[model samples]
Target chain A: MPRPLTIEPNEKTILYTINLKTLFPVRRTLTEIFTRAPRRYVHAVDGISFMIEDGDIFGLAGESGCGKTTTGKTILRLVNPTSGVIGYRPRKQLLDAWRDMGYEPPIIDKFGSIDIAKIPGKYLKPLRREMQMIFQDPYGAFNPRYTVYQILEEPLIIHGIGETREERIDLVAKALEAVKLTPPEEFMHRHPHMLSGGQRQRVGIARALILRPRFIVADEPVSMLDVSIRAEILELMVEVKQRYNLTYLFITHDLAVSRYITNKIAIMYLGRIVEMGDTRRVLDNPLHPYTKALIEAVPDPDPKNRFRIREIPIKGEVPSAIDLPPGCRFHPRCIAFDQHPEIRKYCRTIEPPLIEVEKNHYVSCWLYGTPDEVMKLIKK
Target chain B: MSEVLMRVEGLKTYFYTARGIVKAVDNVSFTLNRGEVLGLAGESGCGKSTTAYSIIRLVPPPGRIVGGRIVFEGQDILKMSSEEYRRKIRWKKISMIFQGAMNALNPVLSIGDQMAEVFMIHKGMSKKEALEESAKLLSMVGIDPKRLRSYPHELSGGMKQRVMIAMALALNPPLVIADEPTTALDVVVQAQVMNVLKKLQKEYKVSIILITHDLSLIAEIADKVAIMYAGKIVEFGTAEHIYLNPQHPYTRGLLASIPRIRGEIKKLEWIPGIPPDLVAPPRGCRFHPRCKYKFEPCDKEEPPMVEVEPGHYVACWLYAKR
Candidate 1:
């Protein structure tokens, strides 16, 4: 029998990496500094937060440029945060020591969550293995000049996974099997050029899994794959998750993919998580206007259900992250606003906080009431 | 029945790659009625685009059309001389809005100049007259004619798409082949672009072959749909018929895999395995490996496409008795 799954508490989250209010701004530094006062930065990723369970699939979903990818990279210390807490519960206790030795992280957090402006860069490397990322474009991610074997081996040699050549080769084979790239010998000697798109993606997954990392940040890994092959890839991910007992921060624009794989889903807007909750709850009955719009936008394959249509409140382009309006970021395109006028005054003036609406469902929209009000409702 | 504006029978487009002849479009056959939208949907390298290219005879080498007939407006396009094909059919009789065709626009030229070039080439219109007509086409696709002065890069992805539509309609062709017209745009923009296509279809009465990887988009706009896999149409039916009751295993797998906006379901079912390599495609049924109901006959001989209901065609072993 399979072991029962249980979510570990945040207290036990030793490597708890918190990205509090990470903001990244587009730097027009060269043009602005010379002529006039520096321009205000684009608030790409406004303040966003979520706890990463040790072995859970933490889904980050939103439209393109909603700061999901930025949040993933910042956790790995790839991009510097603007101003917020990125507290990590590291397995290795040397992070603080490295920091004290003056290994500060980066700055001008336009879209970054924290004030990386305050941190330096030296302490980000050793912790990279704890947090790895799989990018969206399979063709673009794999090194073309190198063969498939070389691409898989490059990471192992860099991370010092194995000493001898045979041990490294064995690790590659295991990784291939995990991704169902069967009979590793068939794939070992070939270049990425010989493989199909699905195979290349499997090779990518194999490469990421070869490191035996605990947490992986996958950004739209299967979005480019064919529908016929998507299941194969997704099934491989599910199988690997169980086999390795790993934690994942799955990032994607497609909510359907998240629905199929993730336990919990977080919906983001221009730069903030508008709604997040249990996958079934969020996908089945979305709370925020933006979430509703996104859900409604996805076309159902069942043609008979075409008559039953959900209303999309927001339409048109996502507003520029820079020079954002001082209110609820979605007010401009919100359809629910017309029915609920009370949402206007404060919703446009004050930024809504992510408050728990139900036991597990968390919403940032003001309509569900403030944290205190929600708590009162819960108590009542 | 509707008069067939474009009919392609047994179309075969092959690419002579180093490894082998990739049978990109093999024995493909379909008909597009005047003032109708026929969606050609499948995954990447499914030959949806190759079918479109073959219809227009833009088959780029090392790709060549070895056989089949393409009849546009009851005229055998295959028999037309290269010059005749160019002069009469290329843009005037039938037009195309290719995937990422937004990039097809010249960066150096204004939207006005680009649209005008289509008119100048096809109609042999003078430069002055072509510019005037370009503005009308732009307005038809919901873009402001004044913005025609803007460069391709200046316009948003959606606007550039609208410009492509405008260019495709410049000569008022009876047929327009739109391959993945709005794949790159956001959902909102995708909706708007699709709306524009529907609106233009109504206005101009031009038949459209809307080819895309998205089945849902096909559901929303396409009146009829052809589900292609490994260069052949496994199933062809009305959008309502195909989406509601997919007879083919491949079609069912596609519908099951997509995540729906409404309803609470346990989990989205994913189709296992990949499409067989076209260079050496599976012997009997291409989808036999992934099909849940595969029998011995499915492994040995290809199932012929049979009509299960009015206008609904499915090629599968389960439906072989039909």
Candidate 2:
């Protein structure tokens, strides 16, 4: 059996150096499958790196098929990465438990961080309590056969939490109450179908929190919900984050939703992150051409601004990920490509490195220039 | 500009289900102008989609347009026979971008073949002439005419939706009904698609009835707005009047609930509880259970729609003159 997993207290500075190469064989003939021939690499998540400090809500904002969901799944090791380090500070609950028995886990570094990506398959069980995920579709996420009670209890049963079945039932009841599903008894026996969209999402959140995880990846948590219920669910998520001191990696395509919750935000294009910085700084003053197009593309609700019936900044839909452009992935659709003829060659041929264009604001674009030849082409 | 294009009065659509009759669209009344866009905004199962289906005379199996008059131009559409309506009205005068465009297109047929089918049947054109028209339509929607040979499966979701838009405008229908055209698309692509519709609406002088659950999208493109609640239109007015000075409790709740990209971070006030079941709806106001300002009259007796201002009409006890 694998050694019992335990670690030190989670405080600050959790680094993630994630480099993934996810390729799916397309247009394969019968003979190709038998021969095991390579077609083309999709490169869903190319070389990408970012840090999520403790208690941070990092927003991954992008359009469809941009690999935001893939990035989240990769961090949790739901999808194995070819290479990279996912350094995580273990659950504080386990630290206290391990301390009482007088033991120290050898895996922890000086910063008390563990590379979760390196952990083998069977050993991932203990780490489930440290991190969790909330899927986009509440309807399809849960098992149809399971009741609210069974849904919440299965995680506890897998991890061997709570001494008896009665104890687990009490824990489940508390989890329900925590999500404000009042009088816990009212919802425990109900199936997912009986509950409305909002109520079902509340149970999704409850299931995630029951593990007492320090981190949670909420993938479009409120997208499937109605507008009125969307806000209510967001409020609940915020309250839970504060009450439990949990960090969240909020993934969504809605910029307004991201603006509300995330402190730090990353704008992704195709697969690579085009821009990353403080949420307000990045959204309010977007740098990358892709980011600007995305921001302008977001349909504003303000009736005072109905003149939004302008031409779409970007030319067309994202091209095939497998047949990526040579230099900048977004050069074909970038408005700056036409504006700056001086850097047109570089924009089309040489991929620009993600460099700090401003304090805490990192951008990858030829317009921003290299670290040595830094130049701001389009200024605010 | 003041010309009234279509007027719907006391429209009632009911579904005779095994459980009971579900009054999907109950007494919904509105006017569509000649070349303006009207937004029908509501939550799911609130009967906004039903109203559109009723107008198109395609309210699926159990649902039927029980009582109402859809006066288009001058003549009442309900008075016309199914055969006459099919030959004259449908696709010739008014067309619809179905709610699910992804599933609307034929999988086996090429984009050109499907688009050409519209022209060949409706306009009595040859296959060659229809294909040429299809190419032109594709060009108008910003898709390459070369993609005509490609099947529906070959195109992206946005491209598939654009194909649907092209088909809707094939005959240059004077009026188009888009039921959540951008519902499942990415915001960027959604914005692009809406822009395409807006551009065409101006170029062809066609009025559009855009039915959607997103209020923000409505604010961007709609000339007039109608807020629906549990099978009833709770509020109706010009987009400016409705957004600037909303009177109905449900409307106010909806406006406040949306988080804005360009505004001060204010607390979103969401409406409490779920919408009532249309089969056995609340005796009075459908939204009475969720409205914070609901009083005795709100739940006891149904409130008649009253004109609070010049053009804005609201159905609520607060707006009703005693």
Candidate 3:
């Protein structure tokens, strides 16, 4: 007997549990061994992992140079990895086992394999349809010379989704409608320069959704838009996410924004995932020191509430990604470091592994160590 | 508590482009009190930048200040000679921390040379005297004096912003127009940059005209905020009054749009339409098309600024008494 899929009224969408892990280590340089190198070879993304269910919007947030973007692009197979695995359940299989195994693995497919990292320049076209990127700058995304219709139609033509001209036009119209650029006729013939910042970004969203890709990487999609129009775009994306049944890897520097759209959030620091868990848990009650600092940095809108805010003064600048420290990436600036001396020694000597603190909540701090006398060291 | 430092009345800055006459700042009026931080908040093309540019007479070619009176420290800055204005006002009495001014610094020259230029141009100080003052200024902004020798590229983005602040304050300017000071830096870096601005403003007693799109940022630093839309002031009030009780529809929309780190939104509501074109703005209220609470009077006639309470002003037909 076939099981019937039931839709519960007023019930939240049950997303497929997909816990993804992407780990890669950097090659040690002479400067690293001698401790006198001008540049440091810190693993930008060292053994970091998290999950985003089918209906869930996942957020990757960190301070600048924290490799939040790198983690997103790597999961989308935009960058080649030195080590570790990327797990995903897609509707179709475009990537083969060799590609998944990492570094110079053989081409498994007969028609010249499309290894996400090593795929030749020619094959990127088809692959682009499966995974698309929405950049931070709306104006920069489209060709200045191309009309709105042309920009939206390019993806449709490249994918060969429609056979007739009318079919393609219909697709473009639908894409525009999905992004809330209503009437479609008003904006189709206009150029990128003709539209405002908010309108131009809708065009960018339309172009990404024309192909109906299952997954998307929206990198600071509304950061550049006007204050009043930011919600309009976010609302449109949320609507489209349900209509298309899509999954997103949302990367942003703003903690407020990440919490707005995503259900699950991962906090990155110096190219490593410091913590990953439910959005409410991570944002409201952040486990890592870096996450706590980020949440505190957001300025409250209400003026009278300003003094009530527990502001954590972020001292000093982000340590250079090219040269990181020997200990926990956030150790130098972390306010909690002095209080936990027993945890401090190990954090400096060795990198902490991502361990599940509670159900569905994970952290990379040495406070929650293995069972038995880990507390004895703390007492001493 | 203090006298007004600068006053702008009936300001209109227009750019005569090939397409049409783009009215960037249309009939704008405001006053900056001594030791006050007035945040001019708006989206891009809302004429916030043009207002600042017009005040300083930095409006470039094809863009002319058609009608306005700019009174700075009891003198008409608009009517002053260019040479006199350059010598007395710019970088001396009323200076500006230009947006991305850090990028404007010469990459080849040392930070010391940049600071020295401001001192030499404004104060006519000797090279030796300028160097000493520059070192002191750098230390004041929390940077090490040794970094005076480093070029612009050698410093981080935050450091560059600090150096720009140091240079702007070299002449003891009473008022600094910071146009989007922290727009380019990261969140943490932004916090640091804003902290420096706040600290410097307190220590020096210099008034600031901060123009930015981020409401939360303005809320943190601004004593009073003026919301601009389609080249006009739509709402003006203290940051507390505006945030807690926004009277204008446009202002309300802006507050609702921002994603908060603390709150959870099931389905965020957005303002329905885009801002009107500044080149050919709407005949009545520019925001009438998207305003949810708009009345018929809003579409037929423009609303004049009305005081609903002490120190709180709104330009909306909904609030204005007939």
Candidate 4:
């Protein structure tokens, strides 16, 4: 009999465990090299570990400069990681190449994933077909001079998807229709400047979809758009996701948008996820103090809760990310210090590990004890 | 409702651009009462910022306030000489917290120097006195007094925004126009900065014209809201009126489109098309092409502002026919 599978059914498909660390050294002077100066890094992304099942829109939501963008870029190896593992289980065919390489990688589930970090530079090119990125700025992403057809067809040409020019044009038309820019011929001839902001973004989405990749990383795709048009793009994204069966790592600073689109969410503060779980569950019942403040700060449109002057939950401005606070990264600005004085010393000294307080929810706060201890406390 | 601090009657600001005349602020009108927070909410090119520029007489070169009666403090300030306006009215009477003003601070000058310069130039305060006043202003906006000595680069984005707020309040101009003050700041810091603005509005009794694209943010602190579309105030009403019962179709669409943090995830209703070009706007209603309720008169003739209910006005054919 086969060994009973421990992992979830969805886990057998895709899971990414990213832990990128120690980034950049702009200028290395001869004097500094001789003196052996201790290298200082931005720590753009520091030891964040989270996994989502196949077809999950895992949202990396946070404020600007919180390393959410870096996390997405690192996963695609857009920026080479100094030290980390980017584990991914591509659909079917890539497994043969893994075995052919004569590398015995550890299997997370029945469908063993290859460590993208371990994969050599040359081998990584093939994986580009498996993953793609939808950039934020539609205006800057495309060649202003290139027609919509040419822009979409370039990816197909580079990836060598079609045999002839006619086949590529047909493929481009199909891609345009998928994004709802109907009568593809009408849009095909127009340059990037001719399209509206919303339409331009739709073209951007079409370019990403033209590749037909399994995983996509959308970085604030709607932030630059007008309020009236964001919904249209979001709807297109959802429609395409269903049609293509694509999993997305949606990155944004807007939590409301995350709640609207993503199924799962991880709220990053500075360079770490303070809280993460099911989007609705985590947003409704946020566990971390930082998460609580983020929820409170979201500008709600309704007038029922008017005139509260929503208090600034966190104490002061965010501390410099270079030399972060010693213990818990959030302790300095954390309102929990006033609410729970008992954990102040612990919060000051030790960095707490992510503990599963609920079935699916995980939080890294000292206020919550171990699983057994928390269960006993709940029972009482 | 207390006292009419400023009345902008039939304000017509037009830009003589090479690409045809751009009606940036075409026949707009609104009033800002004493200590009132009026939110000028609109999408891009809807002319909220241009209206603000017109108020301060800082309408950029190509654009000029063609025809308007700005009755501020019982005086039609448009009739005042440019020299008189600069000496008494502009900056001294009504200041402005410009768009992206957070990064607009002088990089070389200390926060104190920039802030003290406002006092020294406007209020004729000595350097020693101005520096002392600058410290007090900084603290008022919730920045530490010690940061006054630091340059712009030393301060965080939030702190820089607070410094701008402090400098705006330095001359104690009764009216201040903040154009997208918290546009770039994060939510947590935005809330903090909003708290500072709210405190100033309440305790200090300063009248603020909060201009932003965000309706929810406007709903937070605005006493009244003026929704603009294609350089016209499509809807004008109290914050409650606009939020609870929006009159214009554009207002309703805008409200419905924004995803709520605390509510049912209803299907967002997009306005369907981009805003009309200011150069050559649509024939009658600028929003008619995108409007779901575009009827006979909407495409033919422009509709005048009709008082829908007490203190609520809407410029739409649906209301006009009634």
Candidate 5:
């Protein structure tokens, strides 16, 4: 029998990581092949680090190729990271097997934080129950052939939970009801193709929630749905979070939606987190130039502000991640670099480390100065 | 009001699918004036794109414009022959910038070659003259004229969108139809593209039909707004009238649901249900199922489009008797 898992005091961090990176090989051309060109890699996720607290909705925001999706997938172990330590506080059931093996579980420090990145494949199976993922495309995530019942039951079946078919069906019905797909039996026989985008998304949420996971990485869950229905799903997610005490790592490129749902947000640029803090603080008083540009770019839905062309300070396109610029990756298109000549030299020569500007607020820019000599570059 | 560039009346475009007849754009009517941006706003499958396509006479197969009168510059476009329309009115008079239009450019063709093709086919210009004209249009959209030599893949998403804008303006059309021009673009890039579009719109004094699902984007550029639902325009008026004083419940719900960047962050009151299926839309008011302000007549009677105030129109039973 598995040993009972122990809970630690003051362990707020559900998941924390340091300098995670994911790289993929680039395809070479014929001429390059003939010349025996050196291999190149696309730095998809480059040295990003952040902590997700228990029951917190941590938003990862960025444009395409910014690696927000990759970061989420890495946390769920869907995409293996090249390097870095991922500290995860596993649920009780997950650590039971390790305890049963008569091995002292690698619960480091008083907080019981274990480096999930170092865990072997055999141990990852039990841990999978505690960490689940919700994909962006509801249509593509589920099999067309599988009925809604089959789709929801597959996870429980694989995890060897709920011994009888009747027991699993009860759980499925309850999950369906929780997502407000009422009269659950009505949907059980229906296939994914029969469901609308919003309905399918609810099913996706129900599937994710079935395991009652401690942490979930939701990747652009509403980007594919209609705007009218997007809010419904978002509201349902918020309700579920409170009901289950689930920690969410919500990934999206949209700043508006992120602002509405997340308590904390981390803005990514070219695979690096440029700024992070309490959602309101980062959005209301953004210090990073990139963050400022992102906020200014959001089109205000008021005609009074029509034709009021605000000059976006940043110039040029996002630089290619393959041949990343020296020093700060954003230096090429950064407006602050041009405005403040004093910091330009530092920005162009050395990569600025992520440092706390205030309590919980962090930024990685030379304008904020080094940790030892923190400059009051941002106005209060 | 302001020289009408294009006036579409009683337009009906339907898709003959195996399931049923899909009323993609049913009885839609609107007018575009000179130098004005008319935004056709709606959720997905709300027929905003079909309305744009019907105006351009580009509605694809399985879908046909059953009835409509599209009058452009005092000429009935629906009466023109397909060949004549393609040769004369299309691009030369009214061009289109489609969603992900960047991908529409041939990968093998240079930006110069693509833009030059527009002139070659329409104006019967030589390659040299067309290239020169293309370069001019490129610069007009804020892109380097030298990028004419670059391939589509070489340019970023924003640059590619700009190239599409340049191509649309290559013939200097009086009216341009941009369908979700910045849908997939980043916020910063979207701003850049919108800036270029706004500047060029003012410079050229061209009327534009901007179709998008985002209300915020429409509020930024559109002078007039039409809120669509289930293939019908639920409300129509100037941007100020439609936004500041929305009479339609659907419009009200949409505006309320979007989270604002400024002001106090409040809990978004999301509309209850999904948009009606076009294949079998509701009997009367399509949005009644999700509308909180729905009345007894809403589910039984089709609401007529009524002018509540001068130039402000709404199609709802709540304001029907007013």
Candidate 6:
């Protein structure tokens, strides 16, 4: 009665997707909604689309409540998406075995792509082994009752990875060593309270690494730690990525940290990516007005720039996510919207699609022209 | 030279815990000229905030200003009676915009009512007069005076911080101590708040002690910079001197660690090891354990503050002879 879903191999991208939207409904009575109705839906992750290559450190950066965390959580299936598709391509070994079996994988499309968005809870359990998340607050993430050893051991036990108790302990110790919490025996018995902020974060990383997932989403990993210690943690992350052959979806509000670690970065504004490209290209030559404003707003450490009054290009605070402006979400606060009255009608009426303005660089702004015309505009 | 507004000499504020005495602010000294912004930069637990609290005499319990003098406007704050200090000096002369002070505002009370209380208590103004003054203060910080009736929760983070600034200046205090005023705010909002602070400093000519861990933020507002390490000021100098040519190893390490927006994306040279335990600080020099240029003398004897260049002072053995 039902058509079977199937997947075939297309060996280029690790994950590809179309419009991905995650909307949250605000509880309101029917009478209230019928009367002075405020926004019913909060667009937490609004129609965002991006792909992560294998082993690429993809950064998603935005201010607080901009849905950077939501995007990451959605990918890890921590929060289910409302609509759209997420095409996840597993490792070659899994693909080859599935092809040999001559079976159509449930939730997989015709082209060897598992639709992460459509996968039910029961099926998601196996997929969770390949994707894991490291939370923002290390203090909150861990169970206070569990010791460091027990905490790291929990993941391995849940996944049923190790053959015996001794094997699990060995794996836990190795994970701790991988995160550079040296002399694993010394830290094993200690509780979360016993560890410093940096040490606690390392334990969180160790717990995530214990799963040996292919893709890891690190949400504001270093923001909670001291500035001096942030670099060490970032360096550790890089080392672990190389050693484990892992891909990362690094999320942070601070661009400086993003620039330091990420290979590719996507700048989000009000739940949408405004600009996405290689870290160097995006930071050096930002196309979106929001991107330009954010870079300028960062306080330059050089004292020569002190007392030099540079006008802040944007105006007003980020608007409520629920009541986002009609077309361009940034239009209300955009400096360019005020300057270019000719394009104001277009900007206010139609949402701009992400366009490749340069090689591997994408920007979503009406000023840059439409998605189809963007390439020609750049050429001209 | 400008007139000195405040002079802190050998300011020692320590916390007496069960473990040991945490020497939070040990033998810290600096002078703030009138209308000049002096930035207090340090890592967490480095006692930068403690130093600010010591000046205001707001150090929490278990922590006490054990010794040293905090001379503000030629009067030793430590020597002053509690009653006298409260009446004459505290908010009337020196007000503090505390760390995370945006959330410090009373939630139930309107912004106008809370701000007015400062005027009512200090200036002994009527409710009506205080509210009017509060509205004026709100306008000064670029917030709509009409929103003075709104509660703290009603306003955004940036606006709440601006309200804190306005409240700090309500009594027209000549010296304001802002502890990480913009740390929790977004970068764009941070710039806005910084601009407001800069404008207030220029317009009202109030000396500010801006305490934050961010070096870039310090560069923006501070005329003079003091880099704290393990409860002691390792480096103290003009902002230009500190940024251009740092003398202390810790200061240099901090500068190098910060990833710049428009520079070559090289690996950040992070300082190895954590900040020393305040309860049992490292012997001789607290920073010697992590200092890259540590020598035999560094471990045996504490280095005294030496003037390397006219205005710049660094407490390190490497600069002792210079």
How much of the real interface does each model capture, measured as fnat? 0.44, 0.68, 0.66, 0.68, 0.70, 0.64
When candidate 3 is compared with the true two-chain complex, its DockQ is 0.58
What does candidate 2's lDDT look like per residue over B1-322, in tens digits?
4899999999999999998999999999999989989999998889999999988888897999999899999999988999999998999888999987999999999999999999999889999999999999999999999999999999988889999999999998888999999988987888878889888987898999999989988887888999999999999999988899999999999988898787677788898899888999998888999999989898988899999888899999998966
Q: Chain B alone, TM-score of each model?
A: 0.97, 0.98, 0.97, 0.98, 0.98, 0.98
TM-score per model over all chains: 0.88, 0.94, 0.89, 0.94, 0.95, 0.95
CA lDDT, candidate 1, residue B211:
91
Q: List the residue pairs that clash in candidate 4.
A: none
Q: Write the per-residue lDDT of candidate 5 for residues A1-380, one digit (tens) a residue.
A: 11111123356878887888888789998888999999888898998888888989999998899989888887777788889878888766677767775444577657777877777766676777888889999999999999999999999999888999999999999999999999999999999999999999999999999988889999999998877788889999999999999999999988899999999999999889999989998988899999999999888788966667768878788888899999898999998898889888878878776777776688888787642353332221
How far residue A15's Cα lies from its native spot in candidate 3, in Å, is 12
Candidate 1 lDDT, A112-159, residue by residue in tens:
222322445654555556567888888999878887778889988886
Candidate 5 Cα outliers beyond 4 Å, as residue runs: A1-10, A27-39, A99-105, A370-380
Pairs with steric clashes in candidate 6: A6-A109, A7-A112, A8-A111, A8-A112
Between candidates 2 and 3, the one scoring higher on DockQ is 2
Writing each residue's lDDT as its tens digit, candidate 4 over B13-89 gives 99998898999988988988999999999998899999999888889989989998999999988888888999988
| Residues A1-380 of candidate 4: C-alpha lDDT, one tens digit per residue | 01111223354457666555636554657887899977656767877778867788999999888889998888888877778667788766555554676645555445667667677676665677788889999999999999999999988887678999999999999999999999999999999999998999999999989988889999999998988889989998998999999899999999999999999999898888878778998998899999999989999776543477897578876776777787788999999977898888878877666666676677878787633454454355
Which residue window of length 10 is worst by lDDT in model 1 chain B? B259-268
Greater lDDT among 2 and 5 belongs to 5
Model 4 chain A poorest ten-residue lDDT run: A1-10
lDDT of 4: 0.85
Candidates 1 and 2 compared by TM-score, better number: 2
Residue A113, candidate 5: alpha-carbon lDDT: 79
- The alpha-carbon deviation from the true structure for residue A58 of candidate 5, after best TM-score superposition, in angstroms, is 0.6
Q: Which parts of model 4 have CA positions greater than 4 angstroms off?
A: A1-12, A18-22, A25-37, A93-109, A304-306, A370-380
State the lDDT of candidate 2 residue by residue for A92-188, as single tens digits: 6755655555544455567777777777676676777888999999999999899999999999999889999999999999999999998888899
